[model samples]
Target: MTKNDEKYLIEYINLKRHEYLNDLQVLLGYAQLGKMDKIFEYIQKVIDKCNDERTVFNSDMDSIMKYIKNKIEDK
Candidate 1:
């Protein structure tokens, strides 16, 4: 990805870092529109969410990260 792509991805992660769930939904909507850039962006958000909610994903963190990483990489 280019620098701006990286920047937006990090921005997405930052939003999720604070648990902005509603906004996350909107961003995810954009991602689902086949907007690879936006999908990559929201994937970072999801990764951050999964990271911050470790206790909630105690058994799935690794798998979740692996899946998300694959999606991001595939983009």
Candidate 2:
């Protein structure tokens, strides 16, 4: 909620956006080279990495919710 926190969050989002754009460019290069196998492998790797990130995000949210739930249980 603080201005500093907001600024950091915005920076993080922009950094991630740039990273995704770079990834797409890499994929485009592979396609231009007609490397079908490499393209598929790269795509699979990206998907797997995204899935792993999602799992970590989910677990983090679960922990936050658990803390809130425990607080409510005590009231």
Candidate 3:
């Protein structure tokens, strides 16, 4: 892969990781507050969104990554 491709890939991964980290922070706050019901609902929402992503994208790792690369390059 080219240097730019690698850079874009890293950026994409970092963005996704940042989203997950935010989710974790929220979950942590819920845990600290002993809000089990909120935690459960939050987790369910995350799962549903993940499922929707899979259905909408319909991509494996390689193709999804190519799509991401194209998008990053387009911007």
lDDT of 1 by residue, 10-54 (tens): 754765555566667777788678687877777797778667657
By lDDT, is 1 or 3 better? 3
Query: Which order, best to worst by TM-score?
Result: 2, 3, 1
Pick by TM-score: 1 or 3, better one: 3
> What are the TM-scores, per candidate, against the unseen true structure?
0.31, 0.68, 0.64
lDDT of each: 0.62, 0.69, 0.81
Winning model by TM-score: 2
TM-score of 3: 0.64
Model 1 vs. true fold: TM: 0.31
Error of 2 at 14 (Å): 0.8
lDDT for each residue of candidate 2 in 1-75, tens digit (9 for 90 to 100): 556545655665666587789889989999999998999999998899778666655776555344334434443
